[model samples]
Target: MITIVPVETKKQRAAFIDFPHDLYANDPNYVPELFLGQEDLLNPNKHPFYKHSSAQPFLAYKDGELVGRVAAIYNTNHNAFNKVNEGQFGFFDCINDQEVADKLLQTAEEWVKAKGANNIVGPINLTTNDTCGLLVEGFERPPMAMMPYNFPYYLDLISHAGFAKKVDLRAYLVNKAGANQRSVLLLDKLEARLERSGIKLRQINLKDFKSEAEKIKKVYNKAWDKNLGFVPMTDEEFYYVAKDLKMIVDPKYCIVAEKDNEVIGFALGIPNINEILINIKRGRLLPTGIFKLLFGKKNIRSIRVLMLGVLDNYRKLGIEACLYGRIIKNAMPSGILEAECSWMLDHNYLMNHAIEQINADLYKRYRLYEKAI
Candidate 1:
């Protein structure tokens, strides 16, 4: 017999976070999420998302053994911004059994329905800004930082639950050996043309990071507004994420475009920390894991261009190509083997074209699903 329970206690939440570690112990492609990070993400008081919306996590047990888990989310901000009453399910993990997947997902659906949601969409871990989607393709290696990994059977399991494709997100892989360097070759000329127009590209100043972050946060909220499911992040939420990412930021990959010293465009690439986290036992950071994470930076050979955006008034100035070029050029000399410019909306032609110009291979694809309640 199987039963579903809400995660209300600290121990249950710990189990909710740890279940994937045990389930994926033998899977080489699985990387453990940092324990503290996941804890804070689920905590209302710690994460600013709770300031605007709410979420509830559930665990499925069969004969008293943990079998699966999922979170039912009611994103008030998303609903208000998108003008749709849809709930989300995220942080989903389950065994191979159809029964387990069905029960876990069903629990999420019912929970959301009770919250007055008329539709449901997910495997978004929290929001589209976080780890969203089920890995429908590209399972050859471990996931890059902040991307997700899952069994291929997840495709069928989710479909079996009456969910259908909402949209597919793409990840492009660019290797140093395979990338077209024309962008780098032309960067000087591009800069000169932009310089004539008062736009300049430069590395982010770590010394003034707080101020820089404040400027970029505004650009971030406005830049992606037209994209599907985008909701402007609250000031506190942006600050919360910026604070966490500050520790792992590499100046070389965090580039900005300025018009007379005012930031109007920016690009952020993070070292693929999953390479290190993959080796950290169960994502714990005490006793030994912290040492591995601290010392593993030099060994990482890949990066993820997780975000690249230009203000509406600044889009056509070739700044986007220059940002991608600068990051690619910087990565080549750093012994970086590969980079992924990822999670682009399938229909985002302008951004996709920019990535394609640099010869990035279309490697991985992920999907978000939705169903009417």
Candidate 2:
């Protein structure tokens, strides 16, 4: 028999966060998320996401043993912005058992249905602005920072549960040895042309991070407004994320396009911290884990070009190529050998083509699933 329990207390929440660690113990590719980070994300009071939305986590137990977990989310901001009645499920993990998976999903579906959602979509992990999608291809390696990963069987589990793919997200890998260097070579010329139009590209100023982040936030919202499932992040939400990234952000990898003192485009690349976090047992950052994080950063050899965007009006101005070129050029001296440019919507032809032009290989794919409630 199977039983599902809502995570209402501190103990249950802890168990819910820790379940994935145990389930993936034997999988060498599994990287545990930081315990405190996950704790804060699930905390209503701590995460800015909860200020405009609500979620309930459920843990599944089979014969008194923990087996799975999922979060039923009602994102008011998403619905209001997109004008759709959709609830989401996220933070999902489960054993390979079909029954357990079905029960866990059913619980989430019902909970969202009660909240008046006409359709359900996810593995969204709180929102589209956060880590999302189920790994449908490329399970050979661990995931990059801020990207999602799952067992290959998850595709079948979700399909059997009456979910179908809403869209596929792409992850491209660019190796220094294999990548074309034309972008780097032409970077100077590209910037000169952009400068003629009063747009200058430069690294983000750490000293002016607060004001810089505010400017970038506007560009981010505007640049990505037309994306599927996009909802503009509130100030609190943007700052909360910016604060966390600040610690790991390298100036060279955080490039901005400025015109008339306004930021119109930017690209952010973060060291693949998962390389270090994978070694931190259970994602605990204490006792010895903190040392691993601090010292291991220097040894990181790859970065994830996780975000790169330009305002719609600035498209096709070579700003995107310049951003990618600048990052690659700066990375060469830093001993960075490869980078992952990830989670691009498969249908985003212009962006996908831009990445491919630089010889990035489409190495991984993730899918979002949807079903009527």
Candidate 3:
């Protein structure tokens, strides 16, 4: 017999976070998420998202053995911003058994419906601004920081459970050794043209992180306003994210374009820490994971350009290309060879073009799903 139980007690919550570790025990590509980080994310008082929305996590079991998990979320801010009665399902993981997937997803759908949601969309992990989607393509390697990964069988399980693709997100991989030299040569010229317009790009100042984040937040809110399912992040939420990133943020990889002291564009790349996390053993840092995370950080060889955006008025001024070029050049000294720029909406032509200019290949695709409640 199978049963679905709401994650209520601390022990149950810990199981919710640890289930993937056991589920993917034999999968080499699977990287366990930090227990501490996952705890904060699931904690209503810890994550700022709780200020405006709520989530309920559930675990599936067959004769007392864990089989699946899911989070039913009612993002009030998402509905308010998009003007739609949509709830989201996230943190989803399940076995190959269709019954397990069905029960877990059904639990989530019913929870969202009880909250007055008319439609359900997921696997948002929480929200579109955060990590969402299932890896429908590119299963060759482990995922980057803040990215999602799962077995390919997950695709069939989700679809068979009645979810349909809402949109496809793309990720591009650029190798420093194989970058198109032609585009690299054009970067200097691109900089000169932008310089003539009084636009200059520079690395983010770690010394003045608070002020810098404030400026970038403004540009970020405006730059990605029209993106599919994008909702302006609350100041609290942005700060929450910024504070966490400040730890791994490299000055060289975190950059901004300024004109008259206003940030018009920005790019952020984080060390591919999944390499170290993979060895952290179920994302626990207590017994030894902490040392692995701290000491193994320098050994990281790849970076993920998780965010790059320019204000609408700043488009076509070569700012985007300059940002990409700067990140590539800066990465050379760090022994970084390949980087992934990801989660671009399939319809975002200009941003996609900018990535291609750097010789980044469209290597991975992730999809979000939706269904009427």
Candidate 4:
């Protein structure tokens, strides 16, 4: 018999977090999330998302053995901002057993229905602002920073459970040789051209990170307003995220553009710690896991260009390419050989064009799913 239980206590939550560690124990590409980070994310008091959203993690058991897990979420901010009554299911992990997957989906669907939601969407761990989506392509290698990874059977399980594609998201790869010298050669000229329009690119100011992040938050919320399922992050939510990212955010890889001292665009690349986390043993930090995260961070050879957005008014001003050029230029000597620019909307032509100009390949694809509740 299979049982689906709401993770209500600390022990249940720990089991929920550790289920994947055992499920993917033999998969070389599996990367472990930091146990401390996972704990904080699930803790309402620790994660700001709980202030405006609600979530419950569920674990599936078969004959008393753990088989799968998922989280059912209702984000008030997402609904109010998008003007849609969509419930989301995220942090999903399951075995090939269709029965277990079915129970998990039903549990999530029932929870959303009780909340008055008419439709269900996701595999979104929390929100689109966080790591969401199922890896429908590129599974041989590990994922870049903040990207989700899962088995190919997951697509079948999700779709088989009646969830259909809402949208497809793309991730592009750029590396040492992929940076293309041709673009580097014209960066100075591109900067000069952008300068004529009062736009200039520079690295983020570490000394003013707090204030600078506030400005970037404004730009981020506005720039991505039209994106599918996007919700404006509250100040507390952004601060909660910023605090965690500040640990791995290198100044060189985190750059911003400006015009007349106002933020216009920015690019953020985080060190690819998935390489280190793959070895973190169930993503635990105690018993020497913390040492690996601290020591292995510097040796990471790749990065994930997680964010690069230009305000609506700043489009076509070549500011996007300038930001890319600066990041690519800085990666040359830093031993960071490769990077990924991800989760771009399928129809985002202008950004796709800029990514192509830098020779980034669409190496991975993730999908968001939806179903009528």
Best by lDDT: 2
Q: For each of the candidates, give the backbone clash count.
A: 0, 0, 0, 0
Identify the superior model by lDDT, candidate 1 or candidate 2.
Answer: 2
lDDT of each: 0.93, 0.94, 0.92, 0.91
**Of 1 and 4, the candidate ranking higher by lDDT:** 1
Best by TM-score: 2
Q: What digit string (tens of lDDT, one per residue) describes model 4 on residues 278-338?
A: 8888888889888998999889999898999999998998888888888888988999889
RMSD of each: 0.9, 0.7, 0.9, 0.9
Q: What is the TM-score of each candidate against the true structure?
A: 0.98, 0.99, 0.98, 0.98
Q: Which residue runs of candidate 2 sit more than 4 Å off their true CA positions?
A: none
Candidate order (lDDT):
2, 1, 3, 4
Candidate 2 per-residue C-alpha lDDT over 1-373 given as tens digits, one digit per residue, 9 for 90 to 100? 9999999999999999999999999999999999999999999989999999999999999999999999999999989989999899999899999899999999999999999999999999999988999999899999999998788888888899999999999999999998889878988999999999999999999999999999999999999988889999999999999999999999999999999999999999999999999999999999999999999999999999999999998999989989999999999989999999987999999999999999999999999999998
Which segments of model 3 are wrong by more than 4 Å? none
- Give the 10-residue window scoring lowest on summed lDDT in candidate 1: 236-245
**lDDT, candidate 1, 306-357, per-residue tens:** 9999999988789999999999989999989999998899999999999999
lDDT of 4 at 223: 92
Tally clashes: model 2: 0
